[model samples]
Target: MSRRAFCERHDIDEQRLARWAKNYPAPPRLAEVVVVGELPSARSSSLVIELGQARVHVERGVDDELLARVLRVVGSVC
Candidate 1:
Protein backbone atom coordinates (compact mmCIF):
# COMPACT_ATOMS: atom_id res chain seq x y z
CA MET A 1 0.00 0.00 0.00
CA SER A 2 1.01 3.60 -0.63
CA ARG A 3 2.27 5.69 2.28
CA ARG A 4 -0.33 8.36 1.65
CA ALA A 5 -3.18 5.87 1.92
CA PHE A 6 -1.81 4.43 5.11
CA CYS A 7 -1.45 7.83 6.79
CA GLU A 8 -4.98 8.84 5.88
CA ARG A 9 -6.51 5.58 7.01
CA HIS A 10 -4.72 5.64 10.35
CA ASP A 11 -4.85 9.44 10.81
CA ILE A 12 -1.02 9.62 10.97
CA ASP A 13 1.39 11.94 9.18
CA GLU A 14 3.12 10.47 6.18
CA GLN A 15 6.51 12.03 6.85
CA ARG A 16 6.78 10.43 10.25
CA LEU A 17 6.03 7.00 8.83
CA ALA A 18 8.69 7.51 6.19
CA ARG A 19 11.33 8.43 8.74
CA TRP A 20 10.44 5.51 10.99
CA ALA A 21 10.51 3.11 8.07
CA LYS A 22 13.92 4.39 7.06
CA ASN A 23 15.30 4.11 10.57
CA TYR A 24 13.60 0.79 11.30
CA PRO A 25 15.86 -2.25 11.20
CA ALA A 26 15.52 -5.30 9.01
CA PRO A 27 13.88 -8.49 10.41
CA PRO A 28 12.15 -6.60 13.21
CA ARG A 29 11.30 -8.43 16.40
CA LEU A 30 7.60 -8.88 17.18
CA ALA A 31 7.53 -9.02 20.93
CA GLU A 32 3.89 -8.05 21.22
CA VAL A 33 0.69 -7.46 19.28
CA VAL A 34 -0.53 -4.02 20.25
CA VAL A 35 -4.24 -3.48 19.94
CA VAL A 36 -4.90 -0.09 18.44
CA GLY A 37 -8.10 1.13 16.88
CA GLU A 38 -5.91 3.35 14.78
CA LEU A 39 -2.47 5.00 14.67
CA PRO A 40 -2.66 8.70 13.96
CA SER A 41 0.95 9.42 14.88
CA ALA A 42 2.40 6.32 13.31
CA ARG A 43 5.40 6.80 11.07
CA SER A 44 5.18 3.97 8.56
CA SER A 45 3.00 2.63 5.79
CA SER A 46 2.24 -0.48 7.88
CA LEU A 47 1.36 -1.15 11.52
CA VAL A 48 4.32 -1.35 13.93
CA ILE A 49 4.63 -2.65 17.46
CA GLU A 50 7.21 -1.21 19.85
CA LEU A 51 8.04 -3.86 22.41
CA GLY A 52 10.36 -2.30 24.93
CA GLN A 53 13.52 -2.04 22.78
CA ALA A 54 12.05 -3.74 19.71
CA ARG A 55 9.96 -2.50 16.80
CA VAL A 56 7.84 -4.59 14.40
CA HIS A 57 5.75 -3.70 11.37
CA VAL A 58 2.52 -5.59 10.83
CA GLU A 59 1.20 -6.13 7.38
CA ARG A 60 -2.42 -5.61 6.25
CA GLY A 61 -5.02 -7.86 7.86
CA VAL A 62 -2.61 -9.95 9.87
CA ASP A 63 -4.17 -13.03 11.45
CA ASP A 64 -4.65 -12.90 15.20
CA GLU A 65 -3.67 -16.52 15.79
CA LEU A 66 -0.48 -16.07 13.78
CA LEU A 67 0.30 -12.87 15.63
CA ALA A 68 0.00 -14.65 18.95
CA ARG A 69 2.36 -17.34 17.72
CA VAL A 70 4.92 -14.77 16.63
CA LEU A 71 4.75 -12.99 19.97
CA ARG A 72 5.36 -16.31 21.67
CA VAL A 73 8.57 -16.66 19.70
CA VAL A 74 9.58 -13.13 20.59
CA GLY A 75 9.03 -13.82 24.25
CA SER A 76 11.33 -16.80 24.07
CA VAL A 77 14.08 -14.88 22.26
CA CYS A 78 13.90 -11.55 24.04
Candidate 2:
Protein backbone atom coordinates (compact mmCIF):
# COMPACT_ATOMS: atom_id res chain seq x y z
CA MET A 1 0.00 0.00 0.00
CA SER A 2 1.24 3.52 -0.90
CA ARG A 3 1.81 6.12 1.90
CA ARG A 4 -0.71 8.49 0.20
CA ALA A 5 -3.43 5.75 0.02
CA PHE A 6 -2.84 4.54 3.66
CA CYS A 7 -2.99 8.10 5.05
CA GLU A 8 -6.18 8.90 3.01
CA ARG A 9 -7.90 5.65 4.11
CA HIS A 10 -7.08 6.16 7.85
CA ASP A 11 -7.68 10.00 7.74
CA ILE A 12 -4.11 10.54 9.04
CA ASP A 13 -1.82 13.56 8.48
CA GLU A 14 1.03 12.84 5.98
CA GLN A 15 3.72 14.58 8.10
CA ARG A 16 2.53 12.84 11.34
CA LEU A 17 2.44 9.46 9.55
CA ALA A 18 6.03 9.98 8.24
CA ARG A 19 7.23 10.99 11.76
CA TRP A 20 5.46 7.92 13.33
CA ALA A 21 6.96 5.59 10.67
CA LYS A 22 10.49 6.84 11.46
CA ASN A 23 9.98 6.71 15.30
CA TYR A 24 8.13 3.38 15.49
CA PRO A 25 9.11 0.98 12.70
CA ALA A 26 6.65 -1.96 12.45
CA PRO A 27 7.98 -5.21 13.99
CA PRO A 28 7.77 -8.50 12.04
CA ARG A 29 5.13 -10.76 13.64
CA LEU A 30 3.20 -13.89 12.64
CA ALA A 31 -0.57 -13.50 12.17
CA GLU A 32 -2.68 -14.91 15.07
CA VAL A 33 -6.41 -15.49 15.64
CA VAL A 34 -7.72 -15.62 19.26
CA VAL A 35 -11.01 -17.40 19.98
CA VAL A 36 -12.60 -16.52 23.35
CA GLY A 37 -15.53 -18.93 23.56
CA GLU A 38 -16.43 -22.41 22.28
CA LEU A 39 -19.49 -22.59 20.02
CA PRO A 40 -22.12 -25.43 20.06
CA SER A 41 -21.12 -27.98 17.34
CA ALA A 42 -24.62 -29.52 16.97
CA ARG A 43 -25.57 -30.51 13.37
CA SER A 44 -29.22 -29.41 13.72
CA SER A 45 -30.50 -27.51 16.79
CA SER A 46 -34.31 -27.55 17.03
CA LEU A 47 -36.31 -26.05 19.91
CA VAL A 48 -38.34 -28.97 21.35
CA ILE A 49 -40.66 -26.91 23.56
CA GLU A 50 -42.70 -29.23 25.84
CA LEU A 51 -45.94 -27.92 27.35
CA GLY A 52 -47.37 -30.81 29.50
CA GLN A 53 -48.00 -33.63 26.91
CA ALA A 54 -47.51 -31.37 23.83
CA ARG A 55 -44.08 -31.58 22.08
CA VAL A 56 -43.64 -28.68 19.62
CA HIS A 57 -40.54 -29.33 17.44
CA VAL A 58 -39.80 -25.71 16.37
CA GLU A 59 -37.06 -25.68 13.76
CA ARG A 60 -34.80 -22.73 12.99
CA GLY A 61 -35.90 -19.80 10.65
CA VAL A 62 -39.59 -20.22 11.67
CA ASP A 63 -41.56 -16.94 11.36
CA ASP A 64 -42.07 -15.07 14.69
CA GLU A 65 -45.79 -14.40 14.02
CA LEU A 66 -46.42 -18.04 13.09
CA LEU A 67 -44.53 -19.26 16.18
CA ALA A 68 -46.56 -16.91 18.38
CA ARG A 69 -49.84 -18.15 16.82
CA VAL A 70 -48.80 -21.78 17.31
CA LEU A 71 -47.85 -21.10 20.93
CA ARG A 72 -51.19 -19.35 21.54
CA VAL A 73 -53.05 -22.37 20.10
CA VAL A 74 -50.88 -24.74 22.15
CA GLY A 75 -51.51 -22.63 25.32
CA SER A 76 -55.29 -22.81 24.74
CA VAL A 77 -55.13 -26.65 24.93
CA CYS A 78 -52.78 -26.73 27.93
Q: What tens digits encode model 1's per-residue C-alpha lDDT throughout 1-78?
A: 577986797776887556445443443332234676765444545677666566666776565556655655554566
Candidate 1, overall lDDT?
0.59
Candidate 2 C-alpha lDDT tens digits along 1-78: 777896797667877556444433352122233434563245556656766589787887676557655756775698
Query: Can you give the TM-score per candidate against the true fold?
Result: 0.38, 0.43
- List the lowest-lDDT window of 10 residues for candidate 2: 27-36
Q: List ranges where model 2 is wrong by over 4 Å.
A: 1-43
Error of 1 at 46 (Å): 2.2
Alpha-carbon local distance difference test for all models: 0.59, 0.60
TM-score of predicted structure 1: 0.38
lDDT at 52, model 1: 59
